[model samples]
Target: MPSIKAALSKPFAKLIAKRIKKWASQPLETQEKVFQNLIKKARKTAFGRDHNFDSIRTYDDFRKNVPIRDYEALRPYVDRVVNGEEDVLWTGKPIYFAKTSGTTSGAKYIPITKESMPTHVNAARNAILMYIYETGNIKFVDGKMIFLQGSPILEEKNGIKLGRLSGIVAHYVPKYLQKNRMPSLETNCIEDWETKVSAIVEETIKEDMTVISGIPSWVQMYFEKLIDKSGKKVGEIFKNFNLFIFGGVNYEPYRAKFENLIGRKVDSIELYPASEGFFAFQDKQDEKGMLLQLNSGIFYEFIEAEHFFEENPERITINDVKVGVNYVMIISTTAGLWAYNIGDTVEFTSLRPYRVIVSGRIKHFISAFGEHVIGKEVEQALREAIANTDITVNEFTVAPQINPSEGLPYHEWFIEFDIEPKDESKLIQKLEASLQKQNSYYFDLIEGKVLKPLVVTKIKKDGFQTYMKSIGKLGGQNKIPRLSNDRKIADTLYKLELTK
Candidate 1:
């Protein structure tokens, strides 16, 4: 039976669903309006003045006036905002800064202005509402919900508050769901991730946990802690826990392990949220990819990832996107990012309503021999290899071993497995077959004897965790890249002093 709250919310959920469908049906029109609105709003800002936004009458005009820039390229403008200048990037000073790391530029503070904050909060809220409207399972809405995230205790930078995007979003949970949210504010403020997870376990273990949300890797740690403490499968402990909301990494690789831990399959929603903007969310349970948010105050452009480095490479809008093409997604948002390259590559799975899947990172790939292998290829290969096998992986990464000691150079797979495969050679064959099937460049190289099949170098159990802890990135929105062009991570994995 549905709780009174869940029952009452169903009517509103249907309304939200209808509204989303209405806007999505005309993606290009919605996006064009958003683009015009963004330009008009930012006309008085410093960036707009510098780029002549008032005179920009078309997408081409806007493109010619503003160049595509990564965070490093835009740092100068951001510094002015960080130094407490109003009407610099956006209309007013940003209320919050979403701080992130793992880039060559160390820590990055992305602005979250008053106008842009609600998009982040509502994107998350709407994802769940759409799910409830479609599935009619609002019972989960009544039970306690937990979000495994960073410390919400933010630091003041100039006059603006600075924290992780997830942390900043924690401050904006809708009023109605406040009572149902878990891990009391005190426990959420714990700085250390391990300490936080333990505290979260203590706070959530006895509650009616219906919704669990976080990056899959961190949530796995929390579940392990619960299982260790109670000696019970997570599903048994929290029988009503049915819905999972996750982002930051693809959940396919971790799906088998999660289902095993929970002792059953559950419904899940994937979100594409970053410091810059909330780009997309899973709107349908049966859809291939997330529905791109065209009505949000963000204008999108995409260039083919293959030609991204070439000067004068083409940029296209939603109206020009085609299914199955890998594109480097770019944005001009209300947060004052003009033609900002967020570094993510995506593939369009559908064109009618603009569904997209995050394919890989623009800079994260292996082309040592012009094979041009990507993150999605490697992840898919690994998933194919372990399917229907006794293999339960802990963590995995792939890098080209260009200078292996004995033979021709090949890709080295550093896999940390909880349940090692009984037949290693067969697993490797499956992986090689999948890679060859997906990537034509890699297949051609293999056929021409330019490269060899990948080799698996098993890392010790808990090895990746130790490496992350040593480097001070053990948790909180941190994830290992599925593929790397260099040996930085590969070499470090070999040198880590292990605990097990």
Candidate 2:
């Protein structure tokens, strides 16, 4: 028998499904209205006044008046706001700060005010609810749905509460659905990820867990632990398990490994949520890409990634973007992030429906030899290389070997395999061939002897986990960076292996 909450969820989900469908049909106009509304709402804020928001009547005006800026450029104002200043970026002091990693800098604390909470919370909720509506898979709602979240014990910086975005979100799970949430509150408050995962396995193994949600890598770790403890496959331990909700990293490389871990096929949904806001989600079952959120209090712009590296890049708004171009994303959001470069690059797959594939990070790429290799390209090559083979990559990272002392320059791959491919050497050959097919500059470099083919190094079992633990980054929201232009991380991995 379904609970009252489960019965009502279907109708509410249906409403959201209808709203999103209509929203997708007229994305450009919806985006324009969103931009205008955000501007009006923020016009009195310090940043808005400083940028002359009153003069910004249209998207063109917003673009012409405000230049796109990365985090560093806005740090001064953010710092001021952190020190109890009001209206520095947004209208008032933020209720909380979402702490996240910074690639080059140290940790970053992003302000999350009352005004912006819904953009992160309700928007993501609506995405999941709509998925349930579209698929008519409400059985999971009747059972338990375990969402792997960060530590709930928030730290305070000055007067503001600080914590992981996931942790903060957990505090707001609706009262009706709270009973179905898993991994006891005590377990959720455990700071260490390893200890927390073990506790979760102990608590959830005997429960009726129907759905699980988290990043693919961490979720895989949980599934492995479940199998190890129960001596049963994940599918057996949780027979009712039917759905996987994931985001943060691309699921392509980990798909086979996840299936093998669970021992069966399961429906999965992808989402695009950053510390800044929830951006997109897999709306339909058969869609190749997630639908962009045009009316979610976010105004978006795109700059061609190649041009972004140049002296001057042309910025294109939602109305002007074309399908199939790699563009770095820029956003002005309810969070008071205006003309901000979110550091993500994406490619549009559909125009009318406004669907996009997150290509990669702006800073995570290999261009040591002028052969620009982005995450999308590397992932595509890996997918092609493993096609028709039983190779299941558990985890992997790539870095450039540019030193002449290393003999020849090449891209080095450290792969942790779940299932080894039939032909190891052939895998390398296919990877090289696929890369050449994707990037002509890389092919030219290989032909000219300027760069050698990529080298693959099989990492020892649990090597990535060991490395991540050593660095104190083995936990929720922490990820192994896929590509680096230098040998910093790769050399560390080698040294770790040597010490072992």
Q: How does residue 320 of candidate 1 score in lDDT?
A: 86
**Model 2 lDDT vs. the true structure?**
0.87
Q: Which portions of model 1 show Cα errors greater than 4 Å?
A: 497-500
Q: What lDDT tens digits, residue by residue, belong to model 2 across residues 1-500?
A: 78787788899998888888887888877987888888888888889898899888988788778888888888887888878888878787899999988875578888888987877777778877978887887888877889888988899988999999999998888887788898879999998899999999999999989989998889989999999998899999989999999889999899888888889999998999888888888887788888898888888999999889887789988788888889999998877788899899999988878989999888889999898898988888898899778889988888888885666799988888878777788999999999999999899999999998888888887888888898888979888878888888888889998222
Return the top candidate by TM-score.
Answer: 1
RMSD of each: 1.3, 1.5
Candidate 2 weakest lDDT stretch, 10 residues: 491-500
In the range 1-500, model 1's lDDT, one tens digit per residue, is 77778888899899999999999987778988999998899998999999999998899899889999999999999999999999998998999999999478889989998889999998998999999899988889889999988888899999899999988999998888999998899999998888999999999999999999999989999998999999999999999999999998889989989998898999999999999999999999999899898887999999998898887999888888889988999998888888999999999999878899999998989999988888888888988889888899888888999998887889988888888889999999999999999999999988988788899888897788788888899888998898899998988887774422
lDDT of each: 0.90, 0.87
Q: List the residue pairs that clash in candidate 1.
A: none
What is residue 215's positional error in candidate 1, in angstroms?
Answer: 0.3
Tell me the RMSD of model 2 versus the true structure. Answer: 1.5
Residue 467 in model 1: lDDT: 81
